[model samples]
Target chain A: MKVLVPVKRVIDYNVKVRVKADGSGVDLANVKMSMNPFDEIAVEEAIRLKEKGVADEVVAVSIGVKQSQETLRTALAMGADRAILVIAADDVHQDIEPLAVAKILKAVIDEEAPGLVIAGKQAIDNDMNATGQMLSALLGWSQATFASEVNVDGDSAVVTREVDGGLQTIKVKMPAIITADLRLNEPRYASLPNIMKAKKKPLDEKTAADYGVDVSPRLSVVKTTEPAERAAGIKVGSVDELVAKLKAEVL
Target chain B: MAVLLLAEVMGDDLSVDSTAKALTAAAQLGDVTVLVAGGNAAAAAAEAAKLTGASAVIAVSDASLANGLAEPLAALVVSMAGDFEHIVAPSTATGKNVMPRVAALLDVMVISDVMTIVDGDTFERPIYAGNAIQTVKSADAKKVMTIRTAGFDAAGEGGSAAVSDGAAADNPGLSEWVEDKVEESDRPDLTSAKIVVSGGRGVGSEENFAIIEKLADKLGAAVGASRAAVDSGYAPNDWQVGQTGKVVAPELYIAVGISGAIQHLAGMKDSKIIVAINKDEEAPIFQVADYGLVADLFDAVPELEGKLG
Candidate 1:
């Protein structure tokens, strides 16, 4: 069975993002960009499924501007069989919401008919955590989210989810959706040889218009502002001083 | 707009603390009707009826819903979607797993982990690991949201809401519960704890984490760990406190040897009073700390424990 993994391009995890001076949105100019950390785990999981002989092919897809092709290429180098880029205009890509992204993925699913769909639980950028669930609903398929462990059998997959109280395992039929969580697995880096080979891999590019998906924003961002900063306080000279200060001020 | 608040319950007992916080969030929108979906939910429904600001409690009991599977719970919420203009629940794992599906089936966008209700249509939420706050206005006719319980106080008791039976929808049977392994603990929950003592990579080894435990026990605080410590196997995955893990806002948070990466800060920077102890005086954790002590955790932790005693 073929597996489809949706990746996203966002600000690098380590980079501290700055809100635009105009309060319109985050400033992304000249900053480092990379595939979302969670999506990298999704790609890693799909590749492992293929290595385990449970999947025939792993396809990585991304929705954004032309730069997104770079993210798809990284996935290809990692282990995806091929890549698909659903290119959008700069403005459209900048403001594309999870619902729109889900719609675009739905169109791709209809065309590819992959047996399973794996995606990141949430993008670190918007942190919406909605796309995978929304896509499953649109496709009328079952979903297991925040999966820490996934085992695929004949026509069903048992997924162990990381929940609030504890771990909860659920079994879903094939042709379902699964979202990757942090503890799923440690992602492997692409070797130099694999990176060179990825250059020759077939990369099919399409536009949102090709799939007839309305890449429109439903939510309007009124403003973006920095969070309240906590001022650094005085340092205590020693344990006795610290204990005394705590007693007088806090305790 | 009438709001439907999903009650978080464990077995037959209601997680009244979290449900009350969710109710507080829902009350901001308009009248709230609580939905208790689980097996043997009568007791939980009775508790939900006592939550202030709710007009009524709807009880949905079934074997399929006993485990709070996403498919069945989402279906139940969708079936009742037409009765209210907004659907809200605490941003717990259950809410995060189920509410998005409900919103999608209803063909609307879900505003998740809402920190503030700017108006009926607009909300404030943290993005970029709480480094930035974004104000968003939704255009959907029906709004679906999960409230970050840390942002609101719990609604008081002494309410007299009515309890009624809710019709059970057919279980999609798309998923089944196998089993669960819960880490039973006698300590206060990390999220609700007034004080939290967290260790980091500098703790050296798993065995050394005992210092952290002893400190927490002395202060009746919850034990937390930075991702680095959890990755090193010094702590359990549940003890991880960061953007990818649990978001906590305790009255006092003590960091031992934690360097305070942005992801780690995202989780605990909301803490009321932060105290950092690290040999490295330049550690980023010191920037957000209300008090800083430059000392090795191995020495300082033991000294602090003795002093507290």
Candidate 2:
């Protein structure tokens, strides 16, 4: 079965995000961006399925500006067979909500018709964790989220989901949506040859309007300001003294 | 304005903590309706009825929801979404998974990990691993969301309401629950545990974690580990407490052999009492620690465990 993996470009996890001085939103004019960490897990999981021969073909898709082509190339280096870029993600008024992205993804999925869809649990930037479920709902497909492990058995796959207390294993059929959890597998760095080959692989570009989706955001950002900084407090010498100080100040 | 809480049921019983928290959040929008999903969830329905602010309890027991897994749960929520303006669940893993799907199905934007419900459409959530808080406002007609459990107090226990089968919807396509292989631990759950004793690479090896465990057992605490420990394969991912991992707000948090990386502190700094034990007195963890003890974890943990025991 063909596997489809979705990726997004976001601020590198190590880089601290700064709010725009204008209070419009985060200052993203020149911030460093990379493939979202969770999407790395998605790419890794899809690659693993192909490596294990569970998936016949793997296609990577990204919904964003032309810069997202870099993200799709990164997915290619991770071993996807081809890539699709919804280039109109650069539209001046596109909503930041995952559902708007999902609307475009629904169009892409209809064309590719992959049996399995894999994506990161959530992008670190928004931390919304909504897209995969949104895509599943739009396609009327089943979703197994926060998956730690996935084992395919013919038409059915056994997925181990990471939960609050522990793990829950679930069986899902083909044509399912699954979001990768952190424990799924460590993603591999693209080999030099694969990186070079990624340039040669096919990259298709489409517009959000092609899918009849309004890219305008529903929720407007009235203001985005930095959270207040916490004050550094005194460190007590001993446990007894610490308790006494805390009791006086807080209790 | 009316609110509906999709109460997460543990087995056939009510997760008192989740129900109470969901009710507390639902009170922000309007009248509260607690939804219980599972077979023979009568006990859970009864417990939900006691939620102080909840107007009613809508118990929807079905074999499809027996496992409390997301796929079927989302479908159930979708079938009932038209009745409420606000739908919320505890920001646990299950809620995180299902709530977003509900939003997606309803074609509305969702606000997640909300710490405080300021109004029907506005809320505050922490970003940058709780270092920076973001206050967001949702314009969606139907608000689908999850509340951070630690951010709000649980609803008081005492309201009378009737319980009955709400609605049984069709299970979504493609997913079904099989079995769960839970890592059974004697200590309390890391998120809910009042006391958490965490270890780091300084703890040395996978075997060295037992010292932290012994201390946790003595104090009836949960055992946590730094991201470095989990990345080094010294512990399971579940043991990780950091920005990318679980955010815990406990009553007492003790860090042993931890260097106190910024991301690590972001996860547990909200604890009421913080203690640090590291050979390096200058570890960043000490910056947030109310109590700092400069001693080797190997030497200090056992002594502390002995005293607590």
Say which candidate scores most in lDDT: 1
Docking quality band of candidate 1, CAPRI definitions: medium
Candidate 2, chain B, TM-score (2 decimals): 0.94
What DockQ number belongs to candidate 1?
Answer: 0.70
What lDDT would each prediction earn against the true structure? 0.90, 0.81
- Residues A167-234, candidate 1: write the lDDT tens digits: 88888987899999988987899999999999999899999999998877778899999988887688
Per TM-score, the best of the predicted structures is 1
lDDT of 2 by residue, B57-159 (tens): 8888788888876777888888888878998998878788888888888889878888887777788776666655667778788988888877678899878
lDDT of 1 at B189: 82
lDDT, candidate 1, at B88: 93
* Candidate 1 all-Cα RMSD: 1.9
Per-residue lDDT of B178 in model 2: 86
lDDT of 2 at A211: 82
DockQ of each: 0.70, 0.52
